[model samples]
Target: MKMTRFLATGVSVALVLAIPNIVTAKPEVQGQVDFFGGDGVLRSAEFDARIDNSGAAEGRMIFIDPSAAAESDPDGPGEAVAGAQGLLIDADFDCLVVTNNRAVMSGVIVDSNTPERIGRRILVTVEDNGRGRRSPPRRLTWGIYPNQARNWTPTDGELGFDPGAGTSWLASDAEREDDVPVPSNRSEAVSCDSFPPGSHTLVDIGRDDGNIRVRP
Candidate 1:
């Protein structure tokens, strides 16, 4: 009876440790996205996540809104160019699916500068191409005019169009005028070869090499 008890205890402890490994054995993705200097308004995001089937994520997802520079006055003091409007969304991730070259993740916003954005959901996709320029550098790199172009680098210097992965997002649902439903019951440890079908908005490209990653 003592031997049986010892065996059961050992098995229980082993299972306990193994369960955590299983949970974390899934996919993990993290990266920064800057869609500014491109077309449209400045809509960028950053995230790091690895969630389970519960669909409730414990990570980070911050989105920035474009707020053209605080218009400057030729005769008045210069205005601050805080690129993005004060729009950052602290969120929890619940899903992370990876394809052969891309990783897709989703999360729900907990707080934000805008009240209507609270409780909304957003999804991001990162494409891994073995590290390279996301897009060729343009005059946007020199900060000259609104040419509707963007690059990974801010100048034509050595870092001009630095190497990094490409990241995109789908915020149509999250950008609604009002709060949206939270996400749940998403699968973990998935794989694919092509990006999921949809109109995803690229965040210009990663500003550096630590944009994002995915296994297989």
Candidate 2:
């Protein structure tokens, strides 16, 4: 009887340990963005995704917007961004879907109130069409306005704005209004005329302000 009871206890412990792996073995889908594009017709696709109560927290839905380099990938069923590496998706949150001439990006909405959230999002959005017309001709140009140019490192939910860190440029507006889209990652190649005037990497792209670097 004693041996039998010990054996049962061991089996129960083993089963409990295996439960987590079994639950996660299956990709618990939370949500998905579906669209259909074929031939020359570009139809607007409807987005759909849902959460599985049985799945773990890590099983949240993910919509990776690949960079322009691999937008039209002809691989088996897989997640990808237009030309970027990948993007993580989160439900119960508002997001921004930007459509430029070269790429399409669906940026997760971020409240600028938090600092770690800045660079938390990746900068996977890349334009294959030569980054548009060289900032055009203007007495005062805002290098990569709205979208952060470079040198901006986002952590947690806040961003490090550095004007002199990359090829991007920045301008100060006493009466600036609007929200800036944050990227999950940034590119290495920067344009000298892309950043604003400063040496800080932490900046609020939504507002015209100075840049500051964070101490890790």
Candidate 3:
């Protein structure tokens, strides 16, 4: 009888130790960005991101805006807008994996000409109502904005900022007055398939050359 009791206690301890591993298993997701331009044509951009079970995320996104004169004037002087790449650091993802299917990432936009030139730090918030489910088709909404108080310029890196000033560039009147469509109306939604748990592969969708894909 004592031998059986000892064996039962050992099994209980083993089960207790294994429970944490199962409970701590991280939930991750991967997806890309596809949105319509001002001309109403769908444009695709590449983005891959993942969140650990602890709600920390590390990922990258490449933004490519199609040339406005591509179709109308093939030999025009204006070229397609250069691509901008952003790196995701230790951004918060708890809200996404927990209650709300929303995640916000903060990172810097690196310069295209010189890879080391950090142009500006920005915030990107994404929300998916379908939670990556396939049947309903996951709908993703994205918003982008500057996170710093300084203004961005092509020549001068980042300029005009007062540390002690109470003004915020994100909420400044100048930003609101700007008529640029990309920054002003940054929010857009696109349908995508669900990403299953433990899956770590790239999924591509949309047009041929301007396609978007998410990679592990």
Clashing pairs in 1: 57-93, 99-192, 100-192
Candidate 1 lDDT by residue in tens digits, 111-157: 76654455555555666555545643211111111112233333345
Instruction: Identify the leading candidate in terms of TM-score.
Output: 1
Off by more than 4 A, model 2? 19-39, 42-216
For 71-118, candidate 3 gives per-residue lDDT tens digits of 222355565334333223222222222224444444455543323224
Error of 2 at 168 (Å): 35
Q: TM-score of each candidate? A: 0.45, 0.19, 0.41
Candidate 2 residue 129 Cα shift, in angstroms, is 36
Output the TM-score of candidate 1: 0.45
- The global Cα lDDT (0 to 1) of model 2 is 0.29
Of 1 and 3, the candidate ranking higher by TM-score: 1
Rank by TM-score, highest first. Answer: 1, 3, 2
Q: Which lDDT values do the candidates have, in the order given? A: 0.51, 0.29, 0.41
How many steric clashes between backbone atoms does each model show? 3, 54, 0
The residue-by-residue lDDT of candidate 2 on 119-201, one tens digit each, is: 33322121122212353211111111133446544344344665533344444444755545434343443322123223223
